[model samples]
Target: MNSIDKLRIVFMGTPEFAVASLDALVGAGYHVVGVVTAPDKPAGRGMKLQQSAVKKYALEKELHILQPERLKNPQFLEELQALKADLQVVVAFRMLPEVVWNMPPLGTINVHGSLLPQYRGAAPINWAVINGEKETGVTTFKLKHEIDTGNILLQERIPIGENETAGEVHDKMKDVGANLLVKTVNALANRTIEEIPQSAASIEEVTFIKHAPKIFTETCRIDWNKKVSEVHNLIRGLSPYPSAFTTLDGKTMKIFSSEKEIAVPTSEPGAYETDRKTYLKFACPDGYIYVKELQLEGKKRMGVDDFLRGYKFN
Candidate 1:
């Protein structure tokens, strides 16, 4: 098929992570027939319904959009069918019904945040950083019966820097995945692509097959018994999101940035060290984590210096 005569595409995604790929597709001249995002729901203190990032971008691009409360709803399915899309592209979206994913002639291709066969789940970016993997990447694959268990189309590896947070890696992956999406689309247009089964190799051989399950309050609590490096990774992995937290002076404190201190420590694990004049550091199994950025319970985010001026650590 000619580049201009390429198959129509239906995009499904909900968050900002997926926005880059969606924008890239439109900019690359692909015919995005429609977009499917989550329904707007009440958020924040005012409790106003907020549209998804994908929905907002789709509106600006003037593309048709669908925000079905349930994927199995008949009206939503009918509207989706009306688009007559030849292919579907999924990014950071929820699981789809078989009827929906199987509707497109070319099948649904998902832009997974992690390089497939690893970190396969709802929060790939966070898990990669938490697991201390030196490198991570994005993958384009055909959606199949199982979640993220698809035939691989293309993957581009990106290295994780030392002391890097998951948020940083996330931004980089967004750009890399966007470019990879354009490449995959062009290849599909020319029929030069091959889909490789993910099961061809044993799972044991996959070095970094970590799960990126959804984050919760309990999961974000700092485990001081763990090695300092592990605890450090945990803090950065969840930074600026469902952040890693601990209790201080009977109040919850979220830690956004920290530095590992290798010096010998006498304090027990979970004990904190601070001077009214300068800094706050928590003792872990191996060393100390000097918290440089944090937010105390019921307080706004602030630098260590600012936090020290008003709050005294015990």
Candidate 2:
């Protein structure tokens, strides 16, 4: 057998974003010995236990699964050690302790959403869109103690469409990251790829590095007082989850999609201009943000026209 065939891999991740990478590894005929994911947690209106996307896929594949409530638990550590993995691949999983990440002889692999040294944090894709960046990419690197500041193994650039939402970028990135991860693993198994320090990778640019911290509720509030571009980017950055919202008639209305009109608004920022039949837009300093899709308080998400059709003006 070849090197890759003999290499035992332990896959670790939780969300749907991580599923693609695991699937790609399995599809590539790698020997995945174990899958470590988050424990099933109560969720939804029914409050039933919900399995992570990675766990579900692992179950379907009949792979050995482990859901540890705490990474440092002795029982979990012993069980993990028993897997005898040559390499551990992590994507969208919780932070790992030294014992866990340092367990495998070949070391741990991480598939991060953004290029290392840029947008490295809990929410890379969201911050990239929010910053109105034109391009971003995936980076596969070794897992180190210092969060995402690991040595780079492989890199792939992905362009961000001007109006793309974080969710859309996420969808694109998962697939790209999956493919790159497979390539990274195969090269590593063959001992063909070299690890480059993040410093070397950024020396060519040496630009001001941008970070992507976790997004909170305050980050999701739409500030129409800002310039139109900033407000629109904020809306796009948070779309499809914990969406950018503003007060409309003393009630909260979440905007899922919007179009920016670059015209001076007659009304002050945060003021709404709706036809009461079709369009609904909010004024910003330099333009208007036309709401294409929205969810008003106590209402289901719908097109703006549909929302306008059923609502009465106060």
Can you write out model 1's per-residue Cα lDDT over 1-314, one digit (the tens) per residue?
43645679999999999999999999988899999999999999999999999999999999999999999999999999999988899988889989999998788999988877888898898988988889999999999888999899999999998699999999999999999988988887788999888877575856546778888889899999888889989999998898999999989999999889876778999998888668889898778999989999889999999999998555
Clashes of each: 0, 0
Which regions of candidate 1 deviate over 4 angstroms?
206-208
Writing each residue's lDDT as its tens digit, candidate 2 over 107-197 gives 9999999987898899999999999999999999998899998899999999999999999999999999999999999999889999998
On TM-score, the leading prediction is 2
Tell me how far the alpha carbon of residue 11 in candidate 1 is from the true structure, in angstroms, after superposition: 0.7
lDDT of 1 at 286: 76
Q: Per-candidate TM vs. native? A: 0.96, 0.97
Q: Which residue pairs clash in candidate 1?
A: none
Cα-lDDT of candidate 2: 0.93
